[model samples]
Target: ISIIYISSNHIAAASEQLSTTSQQVSQGASEQASSSEEISASMEQMVANIQNNTESAKQAEAIAFKSVEGIRKGYDSTTYALNSMKKIAEKVSIIGDIAFQTNILALNAAVEAARAGEHGKGFAVVAAEVRKLAERSRLAAEEIDRITHDGVKIADEAGRLLSEIVPEIEKTARLVQEIAAASMEQNAGADQINSAIQQLNQITQQNVAASEEMASGAEELNSQAQQLIDIVSFFNIGERETLKTLSNLRNDTRKIAQKTTTPNTEFWKSKRTKSKPKPAEGIDIKLSSNSDDTNYERF
Candidate 1:
């Protein structure tokens, strides 16, 4: 019985250790899952940031395109203005030439009248006014030419600058578009990472639940072990012959006691006191036995 009790205790301890190990593994799996979930959430947030950046890049590209378009329109309008100025200058020069010819004819008339003395004086004064008007017209035409030339040079320079700027702006737009595309790809990748993390989180939850079940199982095993210990505490069989001897003794004693029609506790106690005690650990046989047989020996 002592050896059996020791073996049973060892079995219970081993069972408890196994159960504890199972629970620990389950808990570790659950913790790992939780860590994976955290990583996944971080990835998801990063993806969201990438998406936002992509959108911003796209918007910047659109603004650059609009700016380039506006610059091109301005260049076109400036070129048209330069052409108009050239035409106006040509017309002014023509008017100046016509005025000079009219002034020459008036001077010739004035010279002819001068030979007539007093009669040509008024005509000479009219001729002088005509020459002055012609000179003023010529000066105005020259000024117009000078202004047109300067305007053309300035406009040409502006157009050249605008042409250079257009390509640079286009390049910037392309770069921005590329950035947006890259950002979009990054966002997609992040989304995938996040999804994987979510799956990990789900797996972790399952692990946690499994761990809880394992712990519960361990508790149940511990309870069962305790119950087994309680049951084992009642049995005594330190030796093989000791069990046999105890059984024979119990049978004879019961036979003797049953001979009396009324079996009482006092008679049973007296019989038990008369018999030599089996051993320190006692024996597995009960003094009275029917269908149910239970034996207990106090320390």
Candidate 2:
């Protein structure tokens, strides 16, 4: 029974300790679950954002491609236009030369007409009119040549600007393509992260479940401890005092002997006295209460 009582006491103490530890574990599990849930939510949002950014990057890539194509077309047209303008300038220069030569020929013809005298008057009049027409043509050709040269300068500058812009637009398209690719990679990474977070949440939930089971086990242990205490309570062991020494045990034994041995001792004394002669007159015969006295033999 003492062993049972001690065991119960130990089990109760252990159960209390286990209950505290289980409560702590349960609380920690709940906190971990909450944190995991929060992290999962944040990961989902991040994955969604990554997906949106990937789409945006792809759209930007397409737009950049279109811009590059348009720029290339403009550059090509500018080149063609520039070449045509140069050809027009050349043609205008040729026209100016022809007009100048025509003017010189007309002057020579007029001189010949003057040399012919009466026979050349009509030819002279025609030659003077041709000279006037040639001079006007020369002036008009010079004006057209100047304008064409100006047009050619403007077209050449436009072509040079288009040529310079083409490479930059192509570079921009390449950069956009790279951005789109990187965004796709990032989106994939985000998906992996999201999956990891989900797994973490699952583990956290498992931990929570385990913690709850531990808590229930702790409660059962506590109940067992209480039942042990109740079962031991029936014995009325009172206080659990320690003896610790043989001397103390002897003392307790002597005390119990004194309380219980007196009746037997009195009966023995009466028997011995009755068998013996009575003391005479005023002399009294008294028995010693010294419990350790073993000198007298039993009757």
Question: Best by lDDT, which number?
Answer: 1
The C-alpha RMSD of each candidate to the native structure, in angstroms, is 13.6, 16.1
Among all windows of 10 consecutive residues in model 1, the one with the lowest summed lDDT is: 290-299
Residue runs of model 2 more than 4 Å from their true location after superposition: 112-129, 238-299
Q: What tens-digit string does per-residue lDDT give for candidate 1 at 34-81? A: 788778778877887898898899899899989889988988988888
Q: Summarize candidate 2's per-residue lDDT along 1-299 as a digit string, tens digits.
A: 44456677788888778878888888998898898889889888988888888888889889988988898888788888878878887887888788788888888988998999999999988888888888888888888878878887887888788888888988988988898898889889888988888898898888888887887888798788878776654443423232223344566467656656468777566557645754552212234464333333320
- Off-target runs (Cα >4 Å) in candidate 1 are 1-7, 26-30, 96-106, 236-299
CA lDDT scores, all candidates in order: 0.77, 0.77
